[model samples]
Target: MLDLHNHTTRCKHATGTMSEYVDTALSQGVSVYGFACHAPMDYDTGFRMSFDELQDYFHDIETLQERYSGRCTIRKGLEVDYLPKHLDSRVLDADVDYLIGSVHFLDDWGFDNPQFISEYMRQDMSQCWQRYLHAIRDMAKSGLFQIVGHFDLLKIFNNPPDDSVHEAITQTLESIKSAGMALEINSAGLRKPIGEIYPSKQILRKAFALGIPITFGSDAHAVQQVGFGRESAQRLAKEVGYTKMLDFHNRSPIVCRIP
Candidate 1:
């Protein structure tokens, strides 16, 4: 099992240190690990690892990399917010071994502020989805972030979205396949408002038929969730006909078997 989207104390909301996360992953018997802290965005982002503290973060991960060399392979990653206006240039591209492009904030008004979710809840669900999918398109076209994180997270705030909305989502994901970007099966949703995997079974099945690649991430804020339910996700991936996930090093994909 491998998780590429996890946060540390550096990211205001998360609490685990790099080593602690690695240690937990070790106990869980996961052979591959990734440290994907939240990256900067155009808006007033709330959760971020200070640019000043970046060296220490890298040093810590590097130290673990050396110490756990024979135990588990570690990958440096970033979960970049897919801000449409700034999508052409993002930190996920300049740094990090891998990127998980995510659409967390859809508008220019509310950022990581508390009012964001509340305001999002009040907005029209269809309009919300429109912006979300547009952001996804930008992320896929960016040529960065091989992994597409939570492709349909808008549904989390409002479940049982209308049929027209589902059709719109499918259209966007089909473009994801044509763009050659991989999909992330985020397991964190099981604990969130949606209470299921992001990009539900229907989306996964559609990706299967469209020939999009599949990847897995726990998006674990705490070490306890690192690579959570990875076995089950792998089973689902196989059931959907994805035998392997992509690993991009030096900006190239190296196929890794899921089973």
Candidate 2:
């Protein structure tokens, strides 16, 4: 099994040592486990690792990679927020196995943050969804990432998108396909208010139709959360007719069977 998204204490919001996370993945029979902690940005200093800490994070992962060299595959990555203006070149240009591009804000609004969720009540849901997908499109077009994190994170607060959101989703998926990026079926959403996996089944079916490959991420922020919803994620992938998932090694794709 492979799970490419996880966090470490440096991320400021996650708990546990990096070794604990890797050990947990090992206990869960995960053959390939990656750490894609939130990459630092000038805008969200409190929730992510700082630019100065980037090297330490890299060194920590490198240590784990060597420590568990023969037992398990430990890959390095960064979950970078797709903030065009605040994007840090250091984080973007860092040498990692893969970068998972994600969008957690719409302009100045951190739409998915629970502290700022009340803002959703004051705006049009359709427009909010549209803007979020457009941001995803732009992120995919940037050509800096290999994976898309939490494809439908905008629904974190349970605001399901209507049919009108389809066009934007299609456009975003097209951009992702054109960029040769894979969509991550993130399991973190199941632990959120939405009570489902990211990218909903409909979106997964659509992505399959477009010949888009996929990857799996637990988005684990804690020890127990490592490989938390992997079974469900795997089942969902099979249900959507996905027979293979992408793994990364030094930023290159390696296709593996879903089973």
What does candidate 1's lDDT look like per residue over 194-254, in tens digits? 6778778888998888888877788888878787777777777877778888766654567
Q: Give the best candidate by lDDT.
A: 2
Specify the poorest-scoring 10-residue window by lDDT in model 2: 112-121
Quantify all predictions' global Cα lDDT against the true fold: 0.74, 0.93
Predicted candidate 2 versus true structure: per-residue lDDT over 135-183, tens digit per residue: 9999998999999999999999898889999988888889999999999
lDDT of 1: 0.74
Residue 192 lDDT in candidate 1: 71
lDDT at 18, model 1: 80
Which residue pairs collide, candidate 2?
A: none
lDDT of 1 at 200: 81
Best model number under TM-score: 2
